[model samples]
Target: MTQQVPDKLVIAISSRALFDLDESHHIYETDGLAAYCAHQRAHESVPLAPGVAFPLVQKLLALNTPDPQRPRVEVILVSRNSADTGLRIFNSIRHSGLDIVRAAFTGGASSQRYLAAFGAHLFLSADAGDVRAAIDAGYAAATILPSSGQGEGAGGQLRIAFDGDAVLFSDVSERIYKQRGLAAFAANELAEAGTPLPGGPFKEFLAALHRIQADFPQDAAPLRTALITARSAPSHERAIRTLRAWNINIDEALFLGGMPKGPFLKAFGADIFFDDQQGHCDSARVHVATGHVPYGVANEAPASLPFSVVSQ
Candidate 1:
């Protein structure tokens, strides 16, 4: 049985987010379930390649000292593959030297119900539907996108970035922008500059990370966080004050205004960046690993749900 660490920052990642299962997934999509299972059985001994979130997981796992009585971080594998076909994933984990110990394989079912049981602060997956479900449940979650990042982060420091107005803060302002105009949005922000923006989907997750960061001195913290938002000066005061009001310490805050975020994320050497907008996510994936929050005004589709981030 896997030992539980209740005090640590916990994350749950799906099989496809942890490793590249594109080959088998393609088989499942094209040739159906039987072929997919057969292929998995045939290649059960073959190790899978690392997927987009691998580097981030590696850094998170590395937070535990070599001989600690208890780990500071815990990662649980929550997958859709059945235990029969999941042997390959377990083998791949052993082969890759990853320290992941606990997992929940639900055959072909979604793992939304198990996230709370794992005490997960965050969830990453290739399935947008699952991510949305997790977010709706009030747990922080993101849909992992194809990584174009340089694999390794700056000198082993685990850096994370987030977007504003919809992700870190409720899309209240974003809704104004979409409905009225930029002028009205700016006016409203300036008016409510003293009032803190309501917490968005990621508030609790960020607070948890801040608690971990408190253990180390400012210069030596293992995890570094940045806020890269499209909101520029005049409107920037609200974002700053909102974080201050929450007592959350963000290492860097970039108010790019309307600037493209790809270059900034590349410069930040982020392990993963989260944004609620699809356009920003597409650009960010070119420079670093990106996740789509799919919450708030920016993600609303009148006709149907949006799952294009990693859908076949």
Candidate 2:
């Protein structure tokens, strides 16, 4: 008998992560599964389209090593489909020239239940429930950004750039800025530079990525992180000192004085750029992958508000 091999990484990706769907169609638009089935029946020649995270998973598959001695990353797809559909999709991917380490389908209505029970190093989904469940399970789960769907390789070190004020730090300072204006917030930052603020929700995710990167020595890590913020001159100093005190080493930092960030992030060849403001993230998408952080503020009426910077 051949020896069994253990996986190096366990990645659970949702169906939406693997297929593409029409953006105009709402989940309810298709009478749920029955409608989807009918549509599939009509388009007999075409399989359900690939999803947003398809490209990212494809890139990940390229990173796998064939050597049995080396750690191997395993990707298991969990979806709300029949086992047969799952296997068929897996086979389709295999035939499409993707060297999959492994694949599976959960065949459950809720992707979260399957993810929690199966457990993986990471879980990816466009569905918030799956994302949240993976995060709750202490996994680095994230929603697939549209740009990440189209992204090719690291393009070099998989540059991940973040804004400082509302992306990495708490939104308290941002609230102060919005309520009292820029000067007041600047003064507070100057004063509180020595004091650590509450960490942002993405803080844990960043730290986890950092730890994974730590597997490589300081001299050679495949991932690089940067901080690009609107904070200017003297104010920028406070952020530097604060991050240093907090022991987070940002690979590159820019203090643009209320200038557009697209140029700089693009110049850096970032794989993903995240900001709380949709405007900034929108602009960053022109050059790289970008994402929006939903605000945790209570009682706030949600709207199609253009992105205003927030404290992450």
Indicate which candidate wins on lDDT.
Answer: 1
Scored by Cα lDDT, where does model 1 land? Answer: 0.88
Writing each residue's lDDT as its tens digit, candidate 2 over 114-209 gives 654554656666676666555455455556556532333245355667776555766676677655667787898788777766665556555645
- Candidate 2 overall lDDT versus native: 0.60
List per-prediction Cα lDDT, in the order shown.
0.88, 0.60
- Show model 1 residue runs off by greater than 4 Å: 303-312
| Cα TM-score per model | 0.95, 0.70
Residue 178 in model 2: lDDT:
58
Q: Could you tell me which 10 consecutive residues in candidate 2 have the lowest summed lDDT?
A: 297-306
Kindly list the per-residue Cα lDDT of model 1 for residues 207-268, writing each as its tens digit.
88898888888988888999999899899999999999999999999999878999999999
- Which residue segments of model 2 deviate by more than 4 Å? 1-12, 23-32, 38-51, 58-76, 82-84, 96-108, 113-123, 128-142, 148-156, 217-219, 302-312
Q: Which pairs clash (backbone N, Cα, C closer than 3 Å) in model 2?
A: 18-51, 19-50, 19-51, 20-49, 20-50, 20-51, 166-310, 166-311, 166-312, 278-307
Q: Deviation in angstroms for 288 in model 2? A: 2.3
